[model samples]
Target: MSKEIRNLEPTELWNNFADLNAVPRGSKKEEKVIQFMVDFGKKLNLKTVVDHVGNVIIKKPATKGMENRKTVVLQSHLDMVHQKNSDTNFNFDTEGIKMKIVDGWVKAKGTTLGADNGLGVAAIMSVLASNTIKHPAIEALFTIDEETGMTGAMGLQAGYLDGEILLNLDTEEDDEIDIGCAGGIDITAKNVYHEVHTPSNSVGFSISVKGLNGGHSGMDIHKGLGNANKIMNRLLYESQELLRISEINGGSLRNAIPRESFAIISVSSAKKDTFLKKINTTINEIKKELKTVDANLDISVTETSTPKKVMTTISQITLLNTIYAAHNGVYRMSNDMEDLVETSNNVARVIVKEEKITILCLTRSSVETSKFDLANTLKAAFELGGYQVDLSGSYPGWKPNVNSAILNVLTKTYEELFNSKADVVACHAGLECGILGTNYPDMDMISFGPTIQGAHSPDERANIKSAQKFWNYLLTILEKIPSKN
Candidate 1:
């Protein structure tokens, strides 16, 4: 066990989290962790079932006389988003996370801490192992691959679970309860490009944008941070006459905002120095504009070996125009919920390979019609740019029910525990609750968790004190669950 979390309060939770960190549990590559969980269930003698889609369900009988209370499902995804700084050497497939403690928060060294859902998974494990906490009949559902595609939640069969209430331990804030979340879809645009020999009397250079605070696409879209892909395109479009593009690449996962991007281009030798000067001047101006949110942003150009092939002028224009015209970041605000984002899009990734160039984006909204409208808008933009667009992985939003029994119970419990009312809010980010609700329409669900900052990026950290508070609140809620009529 790492010394950092070895003696933390709520010993069981931190202990289990330490073990989880030792396993390689990146999205979709969860075999070892799946087996580990199964072994844990077997060791504890709990009733465990592994579904076809790799979701793990563990059933625990009520403590003593609480059997008459409703069956509550404590749910969290098993997979964590893997992100690291460009200079970090960690591998998600073969290595474990390196943990540290800084300012009372548990974080990783130069990589994502995996506290997004790993902490939730550890909480469920600790609850299952406890013999002291009083609670209703509990079904702990550990779904897989939530960060990327949500394939585990997607494949969950209807009637596969027997719970009237679901407690999603996936939100980031400690004092806010999330009752609703936005749905989202992924849009991809692809087009073939023909490469021609680089124009004579030209020199090659790499223009790169880096040091921006890329974050969770949906959660951080409104922060006004610089998007590396968008900024690079803007520069290219401004210098279109003097350069011919050879390659363009940026971002990674579809759910993360693009933090860095690089483009390889051939510039006329006679104008190379002037072009570099203009690029540097423009970069400084853009940085000034985004100084508040992206203070560390850097854009630079460096000479590189000459490339034999470059995208034809037509292909280069089409790609650059499409990127420049794409809509990214928050597009609308919620009318019903103050300060909540209603609709947004993130230009998540751009890739240029031998056969084709592709742009991957995600659009999210709480309103179904609005979601489709944004998807259609993306389609039109790509088609106008002479690329084929495909939309997939569409999921519905969870509509808040103010009169929910579980919500009332949770609110009362929070008030009694902390002497203050918890804020009932809706999240702009997509959550599995929306997808799971379709399979169990009547499942009353609420999502809340300890404070996790900078999720989906290398800066992610879980507040230590908040984890204990979250645990206290959850256990109290379990004890206070209403008995069946």
Candidate 2:
């Protein structure tokens, strides 16, 4: 089924991507992938080292005449976010990603294509293994767990390489050169709730919110797509007077905007009519609001077996109000860069079962102060509702250097190759350039890649044509690297 993927243009790059997706490289669970990379480097007769935190670094000598160019650090993450349609039957832990070519794009079957960083990783691997591509001494640094904590980048120490310039091939656009990106922190709120016996003559309904277009929370938050957690909360909040939740589960990852939610809720038989009316009303309003952005948005409710227990009234109300108070969309836009989202929040996951409830969120911003301002706002809201809020995995944002020599070289090279200027900009998505900069502050860094759409979600795909363009552009920039001063 995946043979077509290897047959794509730029056979070296696509072949590498196919081999990568064959391994189970989910975030933070990268032992096999790390070993896979190490073996590949050894097979090529290059010097390979696995760091204390599982990052793989491989060094290759410059090819022939390009020896005078400065040593370069080519980096991309080893792990990909694991997200699949609720109806898709696939296990990310043991099986390779199943991919198909669709109308100039390559996508996974009912799951994330892993092209976000996979394409970048493949590109770096292609460059490393090539004998004909002219380039300076190459240092391929593949860090792990970028999709979740970015701990791999955090744990990398200085002196790991002698590279003067870092080329990060993780950007999602073909025509954009990324100079800066947003920092992010994880917010987790947990609370224990008491469950009560099901009331006599109670009824149950399975509430489902699915078919929403979940994309990268940071990149697609501004598009006004419906968040399943928020939408599910709305239905529960509206029916709180008559409803009791037995079990609620929604969303998978904290970075992928939630696309589906499911809940087994109970209500007294007396209030069944009112409960249905309330949910139907909210469903209509949500459909109206998301019509432009989520035309396929689906919300439904149906009769189900009555569970033996449900959340206590007090706890039920608290969860509802807490989610309602929590912000789930763009908090602020960048005044420094046009069309740039400066700060945002994604109420990515919600769970309520037995005697426990947890809410997980990711807040991002290019500005440090503003990022916390929004995080604190959420902390206050969750705390007031009796949650123990904990913040973690904080990472810095990449600071743009518009005048760096490497940036100038890439800009001039791209214009010469494509006969047009690249869109140099900052992004809200978290990139490893910022965290890696902490250990190597003097290293010149830049990020650029092929066009990828619907990242961090099952709809993720890579543009076939844009990938070729990116490969051509990257090779030219490598050959034009100026000799060290």
Candidate 3:
């Protein structure tokens, strides 16, 4: 709206993206965006259908002579992960994302840019509105709540789509075409312990870890980025001689690597000065060690004027031990594919409540058995620590099919357009393709997108040249689809 939104090539694509950004559509809150798409379809007089869970499908007839070609589905999610800097004052529920153009890249003002799938949605909308592109009969499938959960994909009924080939537009890299993705499950550890009021002689202080480069736990898990919750717990565990733990908390989303964490503890007045000195020294050591990765890391300890309430020794020990023992990074690498992470877990969040302490862990793996094995291992650890564990919303991984016809088409199209082969990969992160495959066993799928960075974090940005390349590649693919034999 301001200054005509510069550097937005492919006017239709930019128009839809800018328009969609004006709607508040975080995970599980996609009604506004979904309705907007439906309205757009109605305005164009195209056939549209909305399911109970807000998944939308807009149908477009084939061009006059191309009606006999196989139907293709253009798929992408409607929701985005809502993440912002701690100092940002914007509200995702009511405010639209503030985007800025800089050096040919589009990014948000201290928040996630939503281009992970928003760009996919815009491309689909652009195709639907185009009158010049040649293509088969098409269906644009817009799913909801993909970031938090694959709800729309899980709820998709068999025969909901008539397309045999689906081109997913949710992947991040422009040069890589993803044919498969890892599956994921949410593992939770909950424990309830009694609390007791401590004598009011000690000083209360809060220790915090902030400014770490948190990213998509799945995509960035193998990068050795620091987990704030893990680092904070390590600090507390090493300082127990001088400090008494009161409360601990960190991480906000299950899929995001924790960037900041805080813990409240009490220290004896006699050892307060010594405690601060050692803590600061340790913080400096950590900063030095992680300087190459988390260059902006900040660790601080400050005295608080609040009274302290203590938890039972049993609860305190259980919580601290669990945090210390739980695995929070890469677990294994793929034996078949070099450098591919086979299994990993993120100890995403920790919360200390009135009567319980809860730890949320997310496990992912390209192999289904490995995923379950890791989940069981984490659950066993929680049980050993005297806690109740629960696993929820487990989804299957999409196995790579070397013989997929869609992959062949995309590969050929890319080679013809760019005069080079496009990289085909099986990603370590989850994609909606897996769930869609489960519902429609015969559906052929492939995922490709422009370059996007820091997807689940505040520093998210989309590359301009990659967007142009993606558009060119996609248009070529659509034009080259052959008639089904």
Best by lDDT: 2
Over 1-485, each residue of candidate 3 has an lDDT whose tens digit, in order, gives 32355336777777788888888999988888889999999888999999888899999998878888899999999899888888999999998888988787889999888997899999999899999988899999999988887888998888779898999998898889998888999999998888777656788898889999899988889999999998998887777677777778898889999998988888878888999888887888889989999999999898996445866666777777878888889988889777888899999999886767889989999999999999998998889998899999898888889899888989988888888898898888889998998878888899999999888999889887888888888888888776877
Task: Score each candidate by Cα lDDT.
Answer: 0.90, 0.93, 0.87
Residue-level lDDT of model 1, residues 87-141, one tens digit each, is 8998899998999889899999988899989999999999999999999999999
**Model 1 lDDT-worst window of ten:** 1-10
| Backbone clashes in model 1, listed as residue pairs | none
Look at candidate 3 and tell me the lDDT of residue 276: 88
In candidate 1 the C-alpha lDDT for residue 467 amounts to 96
lDDT tens digits by residue: candidate 2, 244-327: 999999998999999999999888898899888888998999999999999999899999999999989998888999999999
lDDT score, candidate 3: 0.87
Query: How does each model score on TM-score?
Result: 0.98, 0.99, 0.97
lDDT of 1 at 76: 96
Candidates sorted by lDDT, best first:
2, 1, 3
Deviation in Å, model 3, residue 64 alpha carbon: 2.8
Could you list the CA RMSD of all candidates, in the order they appear?
1.1, 0.9, 1.4
Q: Rank by TM-score, descending?
A: 2, 1, 3
Question: What shift in Å separates residue 195 of candidate 1 from its native position after superposition?
Answer: 1.0
Better of 1 and 2 by TM-score: 2
Q: Alpha carbon lDDT of residue 238, candidate 1?
A: 84
